[model samples]
Structures are given as C-alpha cells and as structure tokens.
Target: MKERVRAVLVTADDTMLVIRRTKPCIPEYWVLPGGGVEPGDESREAALHREIHEEIAGKAHIIRLLHTMESEDERQLFYLARIATWSFEDRTGPEFSAEGRGEYMLEEIPLTVEALDGINLKPDEIAHVLRGTMEAGALGDGAAA
Candidate 1:
C-alpha cells in the first residue's frame, strides 16, 4: 500500500492554509499541502516536513496526527500543524512545473463551515471531519489533542 501525508496548517490569524487547484477540464478545488512518502524519508513526520517545504517553501511545527483514511491501495494521514512563514513564489515542488498539472495557488481561509461550503476541498472525508471539529471548538488549540 502507498502512504501519503497532509497538513492542516493553521496560521496565527485563525485561518487555514490551503492550496487552490485549477485544472483545464476540472472544477477548481482546494486541498491541504502534502504528498506521498518517499522511500528516503526517515518518518511520516519527516516526509510531511519535506512536502511542506517543497510545495510552499514553508516551515511547519507539526502538532499531532488529526485523522487517517485508509483504502485498499493507500493510507492517508492528516496532521495538524502551525506554519510561521511561506513564500508561494519560491515553491519548488516538481508538480508545480509539470505539464497539465494545473494552477496551484496558496490561500488562507477561515476555519469555518461556511468557508468549507464555498470551496470544493478534496478528500471530502477529511474536510467534513475538520469542519465538524471547527464548529465544536475542537480546533481551538490547532490540533486534535
């Protein structure tokens, strides 16, 4: 099975950092920052750190695992994290330059159900979970702990 990691990045302003993806033939959607775990990665957390750096040129302090999704062929782990800074223009992820991969824009959105309703965020399951948690004041501390 393949493994992937994603970050639920929260900023000091009480917003979530996400990637807005726009492809030619598909509807635009938002997603968290992350990618597959490479063989060279020392651990899942290490892989998340590397992905965050590559995708947004950001440094993050991962708080804890928030949610996990599993299927026959893959397991996706979502982590709650806080980011101090990032430069979207300096992103070095190869996917950004790949042909037909579409536009990846960094966006900071309020962590609210209304915000979630306005955009189509991938991995619907995770989005739903996050929204519910936010409404319940569970994300006040930035993680699921």
Candidate 2:
C-alpha cells in the first residue's frame, strides 16, 4: 500500500498554511501541504520534512501525529507542526513543472470553523477531525506545543 504524509502547519500567529489549487473548469480547492512518502525517505517524519521543503521551501518543527486515514490502497498520516518561515517562490516540487497541472498557491488562514466552512479542503474527513480537535481545545493557542 502507498503511504502519504501531510503537515497541518500552524504559524506562531495561529494561522494554518494551505495550498490553494485552481484547475481549469473546476472549482478551486485547498489542501494541506504534503505528498507521497517516497522510497528515499528514511521514515514517515523524514518524508514529511522532505515534502514540506520541496512544496514550500520551509522547515517545520513537527509537534506530533494528529490523525491518520487508511484505505485499501493507501494510508495517510497527518502531523501537527509549527513553521516560522517559507518562500513559495523557492519551491522546487516536481508538480510545479508538470504540464497541465493546476496552480498551487500558498495561503495562510485562521484555523477556525468559519475558515474551514468557507474553503473546499480536500479529504473532508480530515477537516472534520481537525475542526473537532480545535473545538476540543487540543490544537489552538500553543496547546499542541
């Protein structure tokens, strides 16, 4: 089965960093920063680090594993993390150069139910889990740190 790692990146100001995707003939949607766990990766955490660097040109301090989702063909691990900096212009992910690929723009949004409601975040299951965690006081105001 394939494995993927995603980062729920939270800034010091309590905003979450997400990638806004815009494709031709489709409504725009947002997703967390991450990608498949490649063979070169030493571990899941290592894969997360690599993906973050490639997609956003940033380094993060991973706090902990926040959630997991599994299916017959794939498993996804989501980690809660804190990032202090990033340069979207410096991104080097291969997807950025793929032909016919959509735009992947970096956006910072408040980690709130209202924000979640206003955006179409992929893997809605994870979004629901994140919202629940936030409402339960497990992931805001440095609570996860």
Candidate 3:
C-alpha cells in the first residue's frame, strides 16, 4: 500500500498553492504542495513540511486533516494549512524535479467554490471536492468563521 500526503496551504485571501504534474505523462493534472511519506520522515506532519518545501518552497502551519482519499492500493491525505511565504525558485527535491517526476509548474489561485464551476482547475477531483467541502463548513472556519 502506498500512501502520500499533501498540504493545502490557503492564504489570508483564500488562495491555494497548486502544482501541475508534468510527469507520468498521462493527462496532466494538478495537486497541492506535497509528496510521499518517507520512512525517514519523523511523522506525517514532518513529511508535509518537507514536501511543501520541495514542491513550492512553501512554509506553512498545518491546521488539520482536511480530507482523506483512497484508490485501490494508494491513500492520500490532504491537510489544511496556512502559508506565510513561498517561492518557486526554491522548489526542488527528488520525485518532483529533474531527479524525479519531471518538472512541475507551481501556481496559486483563489480558493473559491467557483473553481469547480468550469474554472479550468487541474486534478479534477481537487476542484470537485473543494467547493462542497468549503461550503459544507467542514473546513471549521465557515468561510468567514
């Protein structure tokens, strides 16, 4: 069973840091700033810290386990976080660069329900869930709470 973790860093203005997957070469998709959970990882949170750093050069505070999804033999954990600063010039590491899953395009966009309304979001599933999840008040902040 393979497991992965991603940190969905939302900004004060409600935008998300996303990465366009440029490898595996199958109908390219987008994902949050994160990577796999390695044995060297001290913990899940530690992995999140490392992944975000490598993927988006992002530093954030993990708020909670926002969502969990499983497919066949793979499991993905998405965390809700707040990012203070980030830079694409610093994004680097194995499995996500010249040493791994090709190159990735780091993009940030408004994290809104409209993202699901044919907004050309990547990783179709992500855009699908974001709208309902945020609107359901599951994020615990209630959009304005």
Candidate 4:
C-alpha cells in the first residue's frame, strides 16, 4: 500500500490551513498541507514538521496523531497541528509531487464542523477522521459557534 502523511494545521485565530491543489488530475480541490514521506526522513513526526514548514512555510506544534487511515491501495496518517506563522508567497512543497504539481494557493478557514462539512473534501480518509475525532470527544464544544 502507498503511504502518506498530512496535517490539520490550526492557527491561533481558530483557522485551519488548506491548499487549493493545482494539479490537472484533481482540478479545484482543497486539502490540508502535507505530502508523502521521504526516504531521508528521520521519523513520521519529524517528516510532518518538515512538511508543514515546506508546504505552508510555518512552524507547528503537533497536538496529537489524529487518525490513521487504511485502504485497499494506500495508508494515510493525519496529525493535529497548531500552526505558528506562514506565507503563501513563500510556501513550498507542491514541487515534491512526482507529477510536479505546482502553484498551490494556501488558505485559512475557520475550524468548524460546518466548515468541514461545507466542502467536498476527499480521499474518504478525512471523512473517517471527522467521525473518529467526534467519537473520541476530540472536537471543541464551541467549534460550531
């Protein structure tokens, strides 16, 4: 199975970082900032931190391992991260893709169940994650407000 990593990067203002993927294969989709692990990576968490810095140009503290998703063809690891600072102009990492997917537009949106529900975010892994986070009592009480 293929393996990858991602981050749910929440900022101090209660917004989460998302990227508009420019890849032709995806066409106008949004996702959290991250990528597949590299052979040079020391650890998964270390790769996550490095990826966050590359994707959004920010520093982040990993809150926890939110979920691990397994499928017939792939496995994905998602982590909860509190972001510190960033800049879209300085953002990197889209270049790492094998297809050389380019020019991702970074965005910040409120971290709410509604925000999550409003979009058709994909990979099924994310939807599974929402259910897990909710079941584990992982979400904040005031998030929907």
Clashing pairs in 4: none
lDDT of model 3, residue 16: 70
Clashes of each: 0, 0, 0, 0
Cα error, candidate 3, residue 131 (Å)? 1.6
C-alpha lDDT of all candidate models, in order: 0.91, 0.92, 0.73, 0.73
Clashing pairs in 2: none
Candidate 1 residue lDDT tens string, 20-121: 999998889999999999999999999999999999999999998999999999999999998889999999999998998999999999978898788899
Worst 10 residues of 3 by lDDT: 136-145
RMSD of 1: 1.5
Whole-model lDDT, model 2: 0.92
Instruction: In model 2, state the lDDT of residue 83.
Output: 94
TM-score winner, 3 or 4:
3
In Å, residue 70's CA in model 2 sits off its true spot by 0.6
Model 4: per-residue lDDT, tens digit, 1-145? Answer: 6668898877778777887666656656677777778889998888888888887678888877777888899778988878778876676665745465555677776666667666656665686576466556565432322
Lowest summed lDDT across 10 adjacent residues in model 4 is found at 136-145
TM-score of model 1 vs. true structure: 0.96
Deviation (Å) of 1 in candidate 2: 0.4
TM-score of each: 0.96, 0.96, 0.80, 0.80
